[model samples]
Target: MNENASSDVKAKRQILIGLSGGLSALADRMRSQHAIATKITTLAARAEAIAQRSWDLNKLNSQDLQRTMDGFVGEIKTFAKQAIDAAVRAGSEALLGKEVAEAIAAHSAEIARLTREIDSLPDAAAVRAILQPLSVTLNTLPARLKANTAMLKDVDAIGALATGLAERGDALAAGGTAGNRVAVELSRDLRQFAEEATTFSLKMASEAALAVKAISDMAQRTLGLSQGNPVSDQAPSATDRLMTLARTGPQAGQVWATSVSRTSRSSPVQGTPPGVKW
Candidate 1:
């Protein structure tokens, strides 16, 4: 019984340590994943800048080309969000418990918090200067290009348009490269996130197994000790071991209260009633 009690304490202590370590690991992974998300956001911003440049250049008259670039940028953002969501959800499912539900909720809330933080940033004067001009330029491009084409010769205008188209193509290609980077970073971080969560859960599970073994040993020892055992004057007797079991067993509080009642009833009291009420 003594050995079992010692083992149970050790097991409970190990379980606490394991849980603490696992939570620490999860916190670190969240930060790492957040860094990856930030990188993707930065790349997405660069891609948007490239697209904005392409739009400002007005080299391509085709709306379809512009739409394609816009679509690609949208896809990059969508894919980044989807990758994180899936990774978190997969990790939660792998753990398959209340903690799993809580983790998924935590990650979701974290993403939303990040989004709010981004939205709360003050608009930069420099970015506004560039983007406002680009918007005005795009808005007036058709008229400006048409007027210039009428003033210039057909051949000269065609040559100018071709140069503009080449520049726009280069900008679009740059945006595509940026989008690729976002995808790569997201994919790599997602795998790491899943692995970290899964590993932490497995370690926690192992600690839980130890806790179970200890409890089972404790129960067996409790029954065996109740039949009495040999002991010296210093060593724990059967009653001492039984008391220890009572402290850890179910209805511990009730048993403690009942013991206190019995002690009070047996002890000498100066002026206490025989049948005291709660």
Candidate 2:
């Protein structure tokens, strides 16, 4: 191949390698996000179970239950936001630039909008309406992350192919003209791959943010925490309350689980109508 053609192929090869590296990094991010999603899902389930048990045993009134749900939701919202911010920051530092900043702003706007909707949830039923859908969405997160990771891998493979083709000029063509055409096609493929990555990241972040925001907003409203106001003595923020509850919730969940297991194995123990027998 001519000197100019060889230089062009080398440049395209570099681009392909860079693209593949970005995809690999994104796949790693998705793996980490998948773990976060799994934890959120488990947290939602535990909170819901605790709410149900409290309600059934009349340990909390409807309003109180709503408040508790709000607190948990607040905690989740903070968690989700932190996760997104961290992921975006990490991506920006590693594989991204302005692309992630735009996406983060968009997701933040959506979360704010959902917060208004969550504020309208006045009762336990309303709280459940928001929480249930979020729980369901979070339940699907593992699958979504798996698919995204697979997609990144597939794109990375394509980049590798393009890089290989660029490096081995004779593999695609015997002459300068053929080599030029291969370079043009490889450049086009790189552009398309970059666009796909941007789009995919935006979509993934949007879905995760929206689901968590919806539930978090609901919980904040239930707890009567004013979004516009700063946290104070009378009305602590949902995240704050959730932190307090979280300290005890794990032990409570463990006890509840043990009680449930024992009951499932044995005949129902006679108890007062309203109390659960362990």
Candidate 3:
């Protein structure tokens, strides 16, 4: 080949390498995004399941509080019934027939009214009313406190899950920037490749051009082969290249690209390496 044609071919070879690298980088970026998407999808499904089964914690619906109220109301009602009977009996012993009978009737009516009120008002206020006079420490207070603590913990767990989901969503959004970066770089590479291809075509048309290359030339160039070697005579075979990639790159938290490296696929090992895993 003439000097000019040789130089042109070398430049084209370098450009093709650049084009391959750009496309590989793009594929790597997409793979990373795919892994992230998979993780996010898994996490989202878990979050949704948890949300669907989340416990409803209403203060009024507390089992511990309800038990306490029921016990308080029962005790108070018993005490009131006893008090009314005693008052009516004492008044009967102190008064004449008509007055004593009227006192007993009035006491009975008041007792019935109190019982009806207690039965009708099934709320926290009624509980408080009965509990105030009793002045007794509730048996379920400790259990109720524990339940409240558990409820707070549930809230915190839900909040944490929500924050995680939000962060994952943000990461997915950020991947858009990565996608755009891949597009820009790939576009630049493909555009350069096209321009170089056109230049090669025009050069062939106008002048004593680069020699016509065989189909085998493309296979050789794609693997970066030259003079019966790739990179050097000591280069690993394709399978060895894959094995080396599996061995070396995975150790350092490398992700995205798992294929053998385009350059430096393996260092030339001299001795027979022990049974290598494919």
For each candidate, what TM-score against the reference? 0.23, 0.24, 0.22
Question: Quick one: ranking by TM-score, best first?
Answer: 2, 1, 3
lDDT of 2 by residue, 75-177 (tens): 4344334433333332222211122222222223223333455334334344344344333333332333233233333323323332332343332233333
For each candidate, what is the lDDT? 0.32, 0.34, 0.28
Of 2 and 3, the candidate ahead on lDDT is 2
Ranking by lDDT: 2, 1, 3
> What's model 1's lDDT at 139?
35
Q: lDDT tens digits, residues 159-240, model 1?
A: 2222333333344446543544443443333333333323332333332233233223322332222222221213234454
Prediction 1 TM-score vs. true: 0.23
lDDT of 2 at 81: 42
For candidate 1, the 10 contiguous residues with the lowest summed lDDT are 255-264
lDDT of 3 by residue, 155-195 (tens): 22322323333333233233333433332333333233233
Clashes of 3: 0
Stretches of candidate 1 off by over 4 Å are 1-8, 58-278
Error of 1 at 234 (Å): 39
lDDT of 3 at 254: 26
